[model samples]
Target: MTQSTTRTSSVPPLPPPKERRRLREAKAMTEKQVAEALGVTQTTVRSWETGRTSPQGRRREAYARLLETYAAELDEKKHAKRKRRSKNPENAATARPAPETEAASTAAPTPSRKKPLNRRPVRTVQADSRSRQNAQRRKEKAAALAGAAAAEAAKLTPAQAFDELYAYASPALVRQTYLLTGRRTLAQESVERAFHLAWHRWPEVAVDRDPAGWVRGAAYDYATSPWHRFRRAHRHPDPPNGERAGRALRKALLDLPPVYRRTLLLYDGLGLDLPETAAETEATTPAAANRLLHAREAVAERLPDLSDAHVLHERLRELTETVSAPAVASAPAVRVSSERRAKFWTRAAIAVTVLIIGATAFTVVTAPRQYEPTPAPGQRVGGVPAPMGPQKLSRQDLKLRAKLRDVPMNGPERLVPRIP
Candidate 1:
C-alpha cells in the first residue's frame, strides 16, 4: 500500500498501560509470547505497555488488532465462567446472601457502644508523624541537592566541561602515562595529544559519562600505539631508576600482554572497579579480572616485596614521581593546538575538495561533447582513383602490341616475343 493509505489505515485503539498488561495476563500470555506472535522484540512489547513508545505503521495496527483479539478471548472466557457459575447452584447460592437473611441481619438489634479503644497519645503520634515528615524532607532535600548538582554539571558548556576535565586529568594522566611507557617525553606528548583529541571531540567527551576515562583511554592508546616503535625516541625504553623493585615491576608490566597490562594498570594501579576497568580496556569483566589476577601473580613473582596491591599502587606512584618532568601543557594550550590542528585539517580538506572539483571541471571542459565515430585505421582514398585509364600508346609500344597480336597463332611462343 502507498504511504498515504498506510497512514490513514485505522489502527484500533489500545487500552492504557495497566489495561494492556491486564489483558495480556488475562490471556495467559507473556511479553515474549506476545512479542513472538507479533514478530517484535520483548523489549518493544514492554515499551508499548509502559508507554515509552508505541508501535507504528503496520506493527501498530497488528498489535492493536492482536490486543483486541486477546480482549475478545478474555471476554469469552469471562462469559463462560459466568455461565458456569450460574449453572452451579451451590456457588451461585454462596455468591449472594438470601433475601430473608439480609432482612434478618438488618432487623438485628444494635450492640451497646463500647469504651473508646486505647489510643496513642496525641503528642506522641504527632511527634512520630512530624519526625517521619522531617526525615522525608531531609531525604528529599538531599536528593534535590544531588539533582541540582547533576543539573549544574549538565549545564556546563562543552568547552567548559572539556577544560575542566583536562585541567583535572591531564597532569595525573601524564604521570600515569609515564608509568605505562617508561619515556617521559612520550608521556608528555601522548597526554598532550590525547587532550588535543579530547578538545577536538569536546562535544562527545562532554556528554560522555566518564570523560576522564575517555581521555585516559586515548592517552593510553597513543602511549602504546604500535607505530611508535618506528619513532627514533621510542626505539628504546627509558632506563629504570636504581630501585630494584620498581625496575622489576616495570619489567613485569612490559612482559605482560598489552591488554593485560592495561587492565592491570586500570584495576590495580588506578584502583578502578573490575567492571570499569574492563570497560576502559574493552574486555569482558571476567577477562579483566583474570588479567588482573595473572598480572598480579607475574608482578609478585618478579617483585615479591611489592606483591600486595596497595604496596604495588604505592610503588607505581613512587616510580612515576621519581621521574621529574617539566610542568604539563595547560588546557588552553592543548585547546588552542587542537583548534589550530583542526583548522589546518579543515583547510587541507577544502583544498583537496577544490582540487577535485577543478579537475572534474577541467575534464568536463576538455572532454569531447558529442560522439564522433572513429575513422577506420586505413585512410579512405581521397577520390576514387580514375579507373586505370588506358594511356595513349607510345608509337613503339603500339607497334609491339600489333606485332604480338598478328603472331598470336604461334601459341605460347607468341606471348614470349619469339620471332615468327
Candidate 2:
C-alpha cells in the first residue's frame, strides 16, 4: 500500500471592514443573514463592519468565502436578468396585454390610426435674408426709440423728476413712517422732512438707482431720531377698533432693534418684497431676510395669538391705515423766498470764486522758483570767479587762520587769556 500526500492551499487576505460591509451590501445580505451564514452573533457582524472588532481565524475565512460566493451569485443573477431583458426588449419596455377571450376576439377589431407628420415649411435663401433684414431693422428701430426716450427723460429738470417721484411715493412713505413711529403727527412730519431733503438734493437723489428707497431710509431715520423724542409724550388718537392691537403691536415693534424693526415694517407692514426691503434698509437680501425672520420670531413671542405672518401683516396694515396719511399736494410747496434763493446762489458763487483765487495764489507762492544754472568749473558765477585750484597762503594769512581755529564757533569769539 502506498501513502498519498495532501497539499493545503493558503486562504486569501480579508478586505477592510468598510470593504467587507460594501461587499455584503452588494450581495443584498443583511447583517443578521451574514451573521447566521457564518454562525456568529449579529452584534459581532455589526462590530466587524463598524471597525470596532473583527472576525478572527476560521470565522474570518468563512465570512470572506461567503461574501465571495454571494457576490458571484449576485453577478450571475444580474447577468441572467440582463439576458432575459435583451431576449424580449419590447416585453421589458411595456407590460404585455392579457390574452383576449374568444368571444371578444370574435367581435370587430378596432381600426388603427396613424400619427400625423410634423413637416415645417421650407424657406428660400432670399426669403430668409429678407426676414433677417426686417428683424435687424426692427431691432434698430427699437434701440433708437429707447435712446430717444432716455434722452427725453434726461432733459427733464431735477424738480420735475422729484415731482414725479413724490406723487407716487409720499403716501407709502407716510404709512411706513406711521408704522415705525406709532405717532400720526410725527409720521407726517418725518415724511415731509424727508421729501423736503430729497427735493433740495434732487440733482443727486434722482440719479440714485432707487430714489424711493433713499427717501424711505431718510424718513425712517427721521422717525426714529432722538430729536423727535418730545413726540412720545403726546398721545395721538387711534382709529375705531384699533386701540388694543395697535398698542400691543407698537410696543412690540419699538422693543425690536432698529434694523429688525425696519425690516419687519418694510417686508410685512408695507408689503415690500425681500429685495426691495433690503434696498430700503441698506442691507444685503439674505441679511434683510434674516432680520425679517428674527423680527417675526420676536413679534410672535410677544403676541402669541398673532403668530402667522399674513395675519400679523393684515393687523399691522389695519393699525397703520387707521391713521390717515396727509394728502400729497400736486406740487411741493416753495418755502424759500425768491430773494433768499438769489442770495444763496450769489453767496455760493462768491465762495467758489474765492476758493479758486486762493488755490491759484497758493500754487503760485509754493511753486519752484526759476534761477540761472551754476557756471561750470573755471567759469565765473555771478560776479565771482570759480576757484581753479588750491591757493598758497601767505604767513599773515596762516597766522589769521590759526587765530580763527582757537575762537569759539557757536558764540562770540573771545581772546584766550594768556598765563601771567
User: Per-candidate TM vs. native?
Assistant: 0.55, 0.43
lDDT by residue (tens digit), candidate 2, 387-410? 799899999999989988877665
For candidate 1, write residues 127-180 as lDDT tens digits.
667977998999999999989978999888777777788888877788788778
Indicate which candidate wins on TM-score. 1
* Model 1 score (lDDT): 0.75
Q: Specify the poorest-scoring 10-residue window by lDDT in model 2.
A: 112-121
Each model's total of backbone clashes = 0, 0
lDDT per model, in order?
0.75, 0.70
Off by over 4 Å in 1: 1-139, 147-162, 241-245, 307-314, 317-326, 371-420
The positional error of residue 120 in candidate 2, measured at the CA in angstroms, is: 16
